[model samples]
Target: MIEYFDRGAIVTSSLCAEVMKKMRNEIRKKRQGKLEKVLLFHQDNASAHRSAIAVAAIRDAGFEILKHSPYSLSLAPSNFFLFPRLKENVKEQRFEDNAAVVAAVQEFLGAQDEEFFKKIILSYKKFILKVYYNKCDYVEK
Candidate 1:
C-alpha cells in the first residue's frame, strides 16, 4: 500500500487514478479466486479523491467508494490511527530532503507488524459503529 511521489510531483487526480489502477491490481492478486468479494474503498473528500477521474477509475476497478463525511473526520482510520503514530515517529526528526523524509516514513511504516494494522482496522470498525449509533454526529474521543 506504499506509493511514493517523485521529488516535485503533485498528487493530482490523474496520479490518483493511476494509483487506483495499481491498487486494484494488487487487490486482485491478493484475492486470487475470491472475485465475489466486493472492494470497499474509503478515501477522504479531498479534491483529488473526489475528482471525476478518480471516481471513474474507482468504478473501473469495481471498487465501492465509501464517502468521507465531514462529521466523520473523527472516525477516519487515517486520522484516528495511522497519522498519529506516523507523526509521533517522525516528530523532531530532521531530514535533508524530500527523499530523506520519504525514507524515514518508509522505515517507520516497515517497522509496524501485522498486529498494528489489524488493530487499526479494528479500532476503525468500532469508531464507525459509534458514529452510526450517534446518528452521524461527531463522537467524543
Candidate 2:
C-alpha cells in the first residue's frame, strides 16, 4: 500500500501473474521504459518482502523498496479507499477488462478535487498519531 506508482496497478501472483506479465508487455509498448527508470516498492515486515526470492526479484528489477513507512493491519489505502471502490465498480459492471478498470479508476481520480485530496492527506498525520496511542494502550479489539 505504501508503494503506489503512477504506472502500475497492484496485483497478486497466483491469479494475476500472467495477466500482469501480458499487461507489462503492452505497457512497455505504450509507455516504453517510462516506468523502468525508477520504481517504488513499499512492503511491511511480511515474509514475502523479507524472503530471498522476493528480495531478489525486486533487486533484479531495480525497484527501490521504501521499507520504513509505518504499517498496520487496520490502516491501508486498499482497505480504506481502492478496494471498496473496485468492488462497487465491479458490481455495477459485472466484470471489466483491466484497461476498463483503469479507465474507471481514472474517472474516479478525475472526480476528486484537490481540496478533497488535501483533506485526506492532512488526516494522515492524525491517523498515524491515533494509532500510536491505540498501540501504546492495550485496548480490546
Candidate 3:
C-alpha cells in the first residue's frame, strides 16, 4: 500500500502515480536484474498507477499480473485498514503545517504498533452487519 504527499488528479483510485511508480520500483529492486522476468507478481487495479505505461514497465521488468478485484481495498489491505489509522494518528497530534505535519505523520507511522495493524485488517474482514426483518434491506451479493 502507498500514499502520496497529497492525492492524484488522474487515476481510477485516489493513489498518486508517483507513489505507484515508487511501489513498482521497490518491487523491481528486490529482483537482482531482469526485473521484467520475476516470478512473483502483484494484483493491481486499472488506476492511473496501473496505466498502460505502468503495465508495460511492470511486464518489461518481468512480473506476472495477478487477477485483482475492482475494489482496491481487496488488493490493498493496508489502505483498507492500517494506513488510514496512521493518517488519523498523525492528525491527532495537532502539529503545525509544513515540515512539522510531514514529520509528525512520518513519526506516527513509524511508531505504529504491528499488532494494531494486524488487528485492523482482522476487524475489517470480520465485521458483520445486523439484519432487521422489516424492509427489504440487505443486498444479496
Candidate 4:
C-alpha cells in the first residue's frame, strides 16, 4: 500500500487510522480469497501509531499488532530495507515541490517487484530470530 499525505498535513492518530482503513481495503481487494483471517500488522511505537484511536482502528480492521521491544528503532523493517531503497532511488534527483517528491516516491515504490517485498519479509524474519537469540538487544543493522 502506497500513500502520501498532502503537503504540510499533520499525521495525527485520526489520519493514521484513516490511512490504515484505506490500506486494509486495498490489501483485501488485491488479495481477494487469498487474504488471511488474521493479519499481523507492524509499526514503530510512534505516538500516533500507538494512540488508542489508532489501536482501535487497527483492531476494527482485523489486524493483530506485532509488538517491538521498547527503543528498538533499529529493528524496524522499513529502516533496514524499504526507506533505504527509496532514499537510493530519490538520491541526487531534484524535485520541484512536495508533490513532486511524493510522486517520485510513489514511482519508485511502484517499480519494486514482488521479489523485492518477499526478500524484505524474509529479512524481517531473520532479524526477528536474531533479536530473539540476542535476548532482544539491539542488533547492528
How well does each candidate superpose onto the true structure, as a TM-score?
0.86, 0.45, 0.48, 0.87
In model 2, pairs of residues that clash are: none
lDDT of 4 by residue, 1-141 (tens): 767667777889998899889988998899987985799888877899899999999999889987776757876678877888889878899989888998888788788899999998999888888777877777765
Off by over 4 Å in 1: 6-8
Local distance difference test values of all predictions, in order: 0.83, 0.52, 0.52, 0.83
Which candidate's TM-score is highest?
Answer: 4
What global local distance difference test value does model 1 have? 0.83
The true-versus-predicted C-alpha distance at residue 116 of model 1, in Å, is 0.6
List, residue by residue over 1-141, the lDDT tens digit for candidate 2: 112334464444322334334444554677875775665544445554556666656655455654433445534534544456557755757334666667766777678689866766556446545655776332222
Clashes of each: 0, 0, 7, 0
lDDT of 2: 0.52
The Cα error of candidate 4 at residue 35, in Å, is: 2.3
| Candidate 1: clashing pairs of residues | none
Candidate 2 similarity to native, TM-score: 0.45
Candidate 3, 9-48: lDDT as tens digits = 4554334334446666776676556554445444435465
- Tens digit of per-residue lDDT, candidate 1, span 7-110: 87788899999999999899889888788967777777678888999999999999997656567656556877899999998899888998898889889889
